[model samples]
Target: MHISRRQLIEGSLCGAAAIALKGYAQPSRWQPGTVRHLLPAVSHDRLLLKASFGRPLAAPPTLRAGPRAATGVRLDSSAEFFSFDLAGLEPEHTYELVLEDAAGAPLCDPWPITMFPGPDAAPDRFRLLVYTCAGGHPATVNSDTDSPYFVSIANRRKMLLTGLSYEPDAMIAVGDHVYWDLRSPVGSVMLGNAPEARRLVGAFTRNLPVPGTDNERKLKRVVTPQISDLYGTDFRSTPVYFVQDDHDYFENDEATEEMVTFPPDDFMLRLARATQRLYYPEFLPDANRPAGLPSSGAADRPAGVSESFGTLRFGRLLEIMMYDCRRYMTLTGPVGGFVPETVEEWLMQRMAAEQTRHVVNLPSTPVGWSAGKWGEWYPDLLQPNGELGTARPKYLWQPGWNRQHNRLLQAASAMSGVPLFLSGDLHALGEGRIMRYGDLDFRGNPVVTVLTGPISSGPRAWPSAWRGTPPRTPTGIELEAGLDPLEKNGFSIIDFTEDRVEGQMFNWKMGEPVENLDNLQPFHRFTAARGA
Candidate 1:
């Protein structure tokens, strides 16, 4: 469903049609479906949209500057889809992205596009969100009869509203955006490396004749629409950076790192495609992978499937190293630790930048704390693994990753501002600063680590308090942890400026008797400055 750029912007059937004037609400012939998904993704540079009966008749959507100001791709399935980018937008200006019908009447409510401050714009202030493990299975039901989807949707809406109230410039959804409907048991037992033709007997769906098929279809029903409802208003105006986790990738807590990238027919591959297609904006290659991997419409594009790591910047105040720790990962490292080769270089460069006030390295899996069930990362591996009669491979101190981790820290120490680590998955809110064990150089440059989670999912049980005595990893990088709190169901916030970076964990409840963001206070708060 590729419509050439010329057809969209040029005078097509919709060009001369009656376009609804801006800022005024009017009746529209091109009615949107009950669900209209208008999401702002990528940098402040792109807009992603999905609406039923949502496509414009001929002329492309009219931006603040008009129809001709946009370019990129448009895709249509049962619903109308779009991923158009607006380049050359003025810095700090808010643009209106409006869709219309053949008659030119605006189809859905117009969305606002806010551009980041320009290169010359003051690098003074910006706000970012860090969140993960949003609502999913084992429904936190309002009523016993309510389905998991119903309960999850209610919670998701609350989280979105709370976030919008903060008016963040952008959001970083760290991972577990949507968990597979099946429980974690399925993931542990089956394998992502299985052949595509191997079909599981029960692929669940919201409504199915056989009652247990369309595993991919259930995702569209149970999760995607909830996302549509959650970010309904805010996404139109703000960018949402998606970093996927195991559930969204394959099963519950695993990404298939098979040497061979599976073909389109594979179940796991099919599941990944469905998640990206219905909800998230299309995938783009990181600098590590070449861009413009060919698309076959049904198959996951080459770079799209392979590349998950990328970067984001805001004025000169901040730069983010968004890591894809799950995909392309092995039990141990060769050159790349948990991260891919291309992304490691990109992150290191940012950490070393003199003008970059803050560099936030976000891994979908936490390096600070976790449930200890998963085996790959630092926190998860620290917990005892009964299967091994020991902890998972200690990557933090192991030869494979130790050197890379040290290099990353050294990069931070060499810069003007101490870089911060942002993570989620512990289902708790915690903050801690690192020091080379037993060394009281607390006044020296320190790396800050902040953890927040349980966006709408059930919060995990975290220790009321705990820390290692001069906690030393395999490689002897000594550290300590503190201020950890559990049952704080919400997202993390980071407010950045040249002087300091402040973090807070705000709480949000899932069901009836809705709570107010204003009345609630942060469960934990911490700040990172130039010199510890």
Candidate 2:
């Protein structure tokens, strides 16, 4: 049965109204929803976990990993969430953690989490699960129907479970973890855009408020289904590194007469930060990482963890320098880039260090593919001829963005390890070898880039559906295409070893039965050997 957009909105509003009435009667600080999600981040000797509860606990819960126990610290910012920071754990050792209430009854099922290998400990192999665009409520912008664009929430959970079954050491979710575009002038099926939609769906207030206030309540209503409801306790075992893109800031990376949403304003930043604090764990601090990086403050956190830039070190084998490109992007023409100069210097320094046997560049925005969006590195515009062309003016795109892009690629190519970059935001699954960048030639050691597939985009959300064009290789860069960008819903499982990195891309298109995903296999695979 086909459901109209208006019908969907009305039904959702009805449910919201019922929830509001129940909350008013209960008068609880936090509404008791069935949304207990756990996100963990780990280092060689420590573990940081952020978990939410369905209801306010009678007292603080405790997490027991073998004989070591850590009491949950209630975050003052969120009512039903707790933080557990445990240090001095044995590296590369699996700890089965049991969460119990103050009364010693099990709160949730026990989960097994493993710490990364120690800094000097050389691990034989490590596996990473990576994907992007896994944000959207099946009932909001899209119905719970199967499409080439999006799948049902149950199916998305199944895919996550399948990936988790692979037992990856860590997971990297590149961007678009949520899809609530609040202030776009363009009419979108995504909730919270237009006035009627905002009113019908719900709106987060303009003012930032303390936790347990009406503002947090409104914010939770908008993000919970997109996040906790979708990933409830499933990733309890795996360490997840979440990088933010435009939509995570509650807007699209769009530039029109009415809005230029990139380089987020203060409210957006605060809202984004607050959402992360409530829903996920921030990137754990690294000793060598600069303390002054964006959001690397001790405020409300145990220590200074970088909310924007992060480093994932798996012993002496792999180091992934992941940076959020949307938070600190500037618009100063030739002087502006996706990240600030300070961050660029840090990234370049890390690339030069080569402390690990393998170094992969993980950024929110992809390097090889472009849908001609305004926020890309290249100044290519989507021409009326349905092609991307640099001859046309791309509004608000800076020359410095491309310059930074070239510099980063060149640095990666110069490194001793295979120049492999895994990125998101392209809404596709593809791989290409970037052999040249304008005047720069890297034929001797070409840089390889991959688009880790989208997790939750439905038919209407694809670039071809919304922007009127499929992603293409940007002009002026010669790319030897391995898997030309294919719009689908899937992810990549990458295995890293001392001498090589291997990847398998698994995806499913429109009209496919969701049940098929239970036994999905890789559609494409590739391997990059270590540098001599």
Candidate 3:
């Protein structure tokens, strides 16, 4: 066991040579058991620290914290995470992150992160940059090397740089952080095995179909290759609050039962639980947790965890009610899916008691897309006569689900007196006002729903259903498409002050501002008075 340095070196060389001959060699630059790099260690004094790649190394490394020169010095553990406590820090403070390997070798070029204080600290003033659906196949191999799949340290750096430049308090990742393994017509590669440390595997892959390609044979070969190079790198970072969408759990328009065609059996349900553990940092209240069906006489049943859906309070001014529509929603069918009775009651109570000036409903899917024209009938759901029969309509823009959730939104807008609906699903951005009819619940009080498309995926046009919709202006409900430029990939920002709330959209690649107008197509802006 106590081998000499020379002997160790010689042995490593012989092993490497043998592997190279077998075409299974690692890069020469990396040696077996030699530490590659170290992440910035988490410290007690630090408000927040982000981990890019997966699990921290065995032995924790040292890092500098606090201000320069007279900054406080501390040691950090590699196991747990660091926090950014809003209470302790002031608004608009810039901090630098420096990472190194065990031997003190620098890992990445140094980067700076700025902390923005919330509206509480600045009197009804806060800013947030919203981004969703990024990270697919890269333009070239060079981009791949520079920025790998989910945990693209380079792309994150760019996002942070742009976010800081605009000085946002928080960033909202709408959903679809990673796509599960699915074949695509595009040449985008799929990730290999999921990381063992995190128990989740193959949850995120590149599945977006490549545009404008006619040859299907060539596309299949190129897209089928396993991307073993970028697996196991931890990409989930920042304080992201997300819900499970179809792509996040399975292929587009795929139902839970249809997912059984794939391996691992109940892929969608299993991945749903696994994804919650791997990515989310928060937990749901015990009362609302999911309980799997009871075991029968012959077999043991699978256990279940509560779905992630609840309200988050940001001071007294903002209340975010996040919904897990996927969990309760039914697949495309005739019998409408019902929100678990418990969830509906809870939502109703929250809306009735909400005292916050702004109540934001973050649903994974939008409320407006109707089925007749905007919805597509999957091959499996078609009949022999080529006519489509109604399947179980669980939140697939069926009239029932829409009416239910819309009523909840209407109540929040009327009771709390302030409502803004933030949604993301279709890779296109749009804004519109909700129309009300009879009572204040769903009739008179109107709510504004703004849809922000995918951050890095293909940009799509708003479905025809969203267009030609009328605005219930007196009730303050309207619908319009936000900044969604086909040629650009980007996100949206909301800046709030005591008097007004400023909504802006930005292009992540160019790091420029976009106007909130139809001419810009997908990108546009509109401001609502703080108390409106």
- Highest lDDT: give the candidate number: 2
Residue 67: error of model 2 in Å? 4.3
Model 3 per-residue lDDT at 531 = 46
User: Per-residue alpha-carbon lDDT of model 3 for 79-137, expressed as tens digits?
Assistant: 32221111233334445444544465554444343433343443365566665565333
**Considering only N, C-alpha and C atoms within 3 Å, which residue pairs clash in candidate 1?**
8-60, 19-104, 196-266
Return the candidate ranking by lDDT, descending.
Answer: 2, 1, 3
Query: What local distance difference test score does each model get?
Result: 0.50, 0.79, 0.40
lDDT assessment of candidate 3 = 0.40
Full ranking by TM-score:
2, 1, 3
lDDT value, candidate 2, whole model: 0.79
Off by over 4 Å in 3: 1-56, 59-123, 137-160, 181-238, 255-265, 283-307, 331-339, 370-399, 436-444, 459-488, 507-523, 530-532
lDDT of 3 at 169: 45
Instruction: Looking at model 3, report the run of 10 residues with the lowest lDDT sum.
Output: 293-302
Clashes per candidate, residues 3 or more apart or on different chains: 3, 4, 37
Candidate 2 TM-score to native: 0.90
Tens-place lDDT per residue, model 1, 405-426, is 5666666655668657787755
Clashing pairs in 2: 148-510, 149-458, 149-459, 150-458
